[model samples]
Target: MRIGLYPGTFDPVTLGHLDIIHRATVLVDRLVIGVAINRDKGPLFSLEERVTMIETECARISEETACEIVVHPFENLLIDCARDVGAGMIIRGLRAVADFEYEFQMVGMNRRLDASIETVFLMAEAQHQAIASKLVKEIARLGGNVAKFVTPEVRKALQARFGADC
Candidate 1:
């Protein structure tokens, strides 16, 4: 069976990221959504909260579908996480040239570490190319209504974290 790994620091999964998840569902038997524990950036949502948001969102992705979602809060490194799960492919979403530059370097490193694994990049939808977890936090922090940009669970989690007034 072909298993695909979609790893990211989904502080709160955005619609854009969800799009990739949906696309990934069609390409593999199972899709592992690895939430990287980004200690350097300091995530706004705790690992538990991120996992909850992902679990709540991923659960609603239609059980009848061919693929299933596995939410994992991964720290340390991505290649290790992928190796642990036996994923031969790393699925990524490309929003722009900048994203490509970074993902490309990481892809090369992953290939060097394990030549058996490879990275796949899918272009983000035109409308959601600019949406990101950082962008979601900035808009929410500034009191912007981001209901349309993310799932309801994510919005609720953000409201809980930043307060309803925010």
Candidate 2:
């Protein structure tokens, strides 16, 4: 099977992620949403909560796309997660030149870990290129409505994680 790894910290799994997930479905036989646990960054939601958010959002996509959302609380390197999951390709969402620059280096590093693993970049829908999980979480924490930035499932997850008090 052509398995593609779409890895990210996905603090809240924003619409841009969903869009990438949507686009990825068309290119791979199976898309594994790998939620990397970034040891350096403190997240708004716990790993369990993030997993639930990913599961719920993956399910929200129409049934035609056989996308599997796998919550990998990876304490190790990102490429290790891909190798563990048997994903042949690493899929990334490219928003701007800055993202390309950063991801370019990452792709090179990942290639070094597994020479056969290919990195494919997908452009986010124009409307969602600016939406990111961190930005969504920050906006939501500040009492800003992020309904446009994420799916309904993510909205509920974020609300529950942040709560009305925040």
Best candidate, TM-score-wise?
1
Best by lDDT: 1
The residue-by-residue lDDT of candidate 1 on 47-151, one tens digit each, is: 887888877777767375757789877885788898988788889999999898888889888888888988888999998998988988989988889887887
Against the reference, the lDDT scores of all candidates come to 0.84, 0.81
Q: What's each prediction's TM-score?
A: 0.94, 0.91
Query: What digit string (tens of lDDT, one per residue) describes model 2 on residues 1-166?
Result: 8888888888888889888888898877777888877767998888888888888777756365655555456667778888888889989999888898889899888888788989999999999989977888888888788889987777877777778522
lDDT of 1 at 118: 82
Q: What overall lDDT, based on C-alpha atoms, would model 2 receive against the true structure?
A: 0.81
Candidate 1: C-alpha RMSD to true structure equals 1.3
Q: In model 1, how many backbone clashes occur? A: 0
In candidate 1, position 140 carries an lDDT of: 91
